[model samples]
Target: FLIDCFVFFQTFFSSQKKMSTTSTGSRLYESSKAVDEYIQMHYAPQDQLFPYDDQYAPSAGFQFVARTATLCVESFDKFGEIREGETLSALDVGCAVGGSSFELAKKFATVDGFDFSEAFVKTAKKMQLEKKLTYSSLQFGETFEDRVVSLPESLNTEGINFFWGDACSLSANENVSKKGYDVVHASNLLCRLPKPKQFLKDCGEWVVKPGGLLVLVSPYSWLEDYTAKEDWVMGLEGPFEALKAELSEKFELVDRKPFPFLIREHARKFQYGVSDATVWKKKCT
Candidate 1:
């Protein structure tokens, strides 16, 4: 039954893609204010930030945060147990709205968060500095509702920094290339890049330290607008084998599992899917 549902969705989505032909390249988030706003509202919602009268909007915020927190811990534990008082650093590549990054900051001493969208990074920075930011969600076609999003007043911002960056072109970014972190977390970012293979190789070589951990999660939703068909890692083979092939030389796969997440489009509609998560320990060079 589940397989049948999956097949139906694939066919429906593929037809939709065919019907909506915008261009050959992915619509970069930098150009889309609506996309950035939607991402912020989707990932970084806290119930306390919204008014009691509008509680319906933030219905999934707690669940999103809880799942992100679990992924952070699982990413760290899959590598090894951390000793008490031991300082560690993490690099959250493609950390949209800083949900997972904030979760990582709680576990590690330092976390550097990066996203390609200027709007997302700016909003994340504002939230870190001010503890709150206002975002909006679509109420109906051509209509939107305003809401405030906040982080725990207790969340430590001293250990976290949000930056705008491209994961595929990490070498040019001094902060990510020079500062090797104990863990590099790339969540739902692989299939979105135009050159995912290069990003995977560059991340293994520069971002993660020797004997460190690399955690990747993706839905394999490869769209021609986001990535060219030839550039996709999931082709004749599946995402598992494709990732293993890309990271095999410098990293060893430790665990593979399914990660479920929910994205609320509006009060009445929600999108839920499971992302394939793979954890790898960087091998000693």
Candidate 2:
């Protein structure tokens, strides 16, 4: 049953790629507006996200980042793969503003947060150095409010290293070249790459060590501006099917589920999205 469906979707989406040209992706993370919005989404309390009523929002602002890392610990424990004294390390690909990296640091022994946007990387490093950042966010039309984003208490940020990097060409990164991680986490980043297929091919093949895990979260929202339709990992069959096709060579699926999240654009307006999160264990050769 699943085989026939995947074939149909693959064929359908392949043809659709030829007909579509415009993309819905916005690659403006380098902009000041994008930086501020991410800052608020990463560090702001529930009240700022839902100014009218904090209780109305789901319990997942920066919590989504925390949950993504926890999924790794849970998976290892489920499989009895948790080493008692092994020094675990993690790589956070496309770690915008360092929310997910900081969250990973709480659990992993060391974490490397990598992103393409210099602005986002700089801000994340700044937060690590200064422990806080002040930014302005749009309330309605022109009204902007100044807010401060502080690092969460009790997190030892000493082991975290932030880097400006391109996801598609990760080999250029010095740390990635030195050694692979015990786990690699990439959230809401697949469909945005200019060449997502390359990233899928490299997940366990290069970045993750043998018997390690690769955690991915994505809404599968493909945009031609960011990625050519021909390069989308999720075709008509959706991300997981196409993802399995690419990753089956070196990885096997361990767990998958919906990971819902919210991002604040302004006091009144917010962007709500549900990303599918999946965990894969690299095959031991």
Candidate 3:
């Protein structure tokens, strides 16, 4: 059953970037256009997942993030209660259009979102602004644009910020500042990388303060080797073992749950499952 579950997740949780102007080559432009189309087709819209109405709650990815967040929050609360008037900060690496960041924003006082794609960042900023307006306690039936223009100062209090960044090379002193974040989240990102152990270690240094939290959720492992360009290498045993070994030394394993979710990116009608989540905390020195 364990092996079967691993195989299932290896197929499931595997799920972007852009450049500027001055493109001269026709082939390059055509390829870029095709890639844009592909991203738009698969990427979930902000409104669809985080609508103005409460009825549109819980997208598949959103659900995963929420579940992970809940676990992280619970772990923190269980270990150390979040005192009143004390602000907590969180980092969402590979935030991808800021849906996860926005979700975390609701829980934390400050959230910094990072993504490699400039286009995704732009859309996420727009979404963030929209969310600010919608949830700003405006009167019923008030127009969002009008309310936003009229109450610009009110939008300033929203608890989220975003920036374009690479997670793999994130620095503790340079990028995030030393001992900065209280919680760090990297969901469904590790399996996409060529060397995930290095990535995980980098993440540990980037956001996790002493006694802070680290939560990672990925359906696929990054231990398997790949030969062909077309073949998707889903598991990497070395990287997985390396992460487990490294984190074990620094972090206390708090709560871990095996979540099963449909892999929407793989074009499967039936839900392709994966071993979904793990949450840990940096040991207090």
CA lDDT of each prediction against the hidden true structure: 0.66, 0.72, 0.51
Error of 2 at 37 (Å): 0.8
List residue ranges in candidate 3 displaced over 4 A: 1-62, 80-86, 132-157, 172-175, 221-242, 263-271
Clashes of 2: 0
State which candidate has the highest lDDT: 2
Clashes by residue pair, model 2: none
Model 2, CA-based lDDT: 0.72
- Put down candidate 1 lDDT per residue, 1-285, tens digits, no spaces: 000000113344434432211123333243333333444444544442343465455343335534654665776776654545657888888776676777788788888988776656776687789887676555556566666666789888898988878788888887774857788887777877878898888877877777788878777878676678999998457778877888999998887877765555545565667878788888877
Error of 1 at 4 (Å): 30
Please say which candidate is ahead in TM-score: 1 or 3.
1
What would you estimate as the lDDT of candidate 3? 0.51
Better of 2 and 3 by TM-score: 2
Candidate 2 residue-wise lDDT, 1-285, digit = tens: 000000113344443432211114343445566667667767776666676654676666446665766776676556425557778888888888887788778777789887877777889899998889998867877788898878866779999998877778887777664568788888878877887777767776778888888888888877676777788887578678988988988998888898887766556666677888889888988
For each candidate, give its TM-score against the true structure: 0.79, 0.85, 0.61
Off by over 4 Å in 2: 1-27, 58-62, 79-85
lDDT per residue for candidate 3 within 1-285, as digits (tens), equals 010001112122221012211122112211222223222222334342234464743334334544555665676677534545768988877665565676666567888876655545555576666643221211223321111211233344277777666665676225454555778887766665444555567655545877788887766543343112232333356434545776787777776777654322221122335555777787766
lDDT of 3 at 115: 64
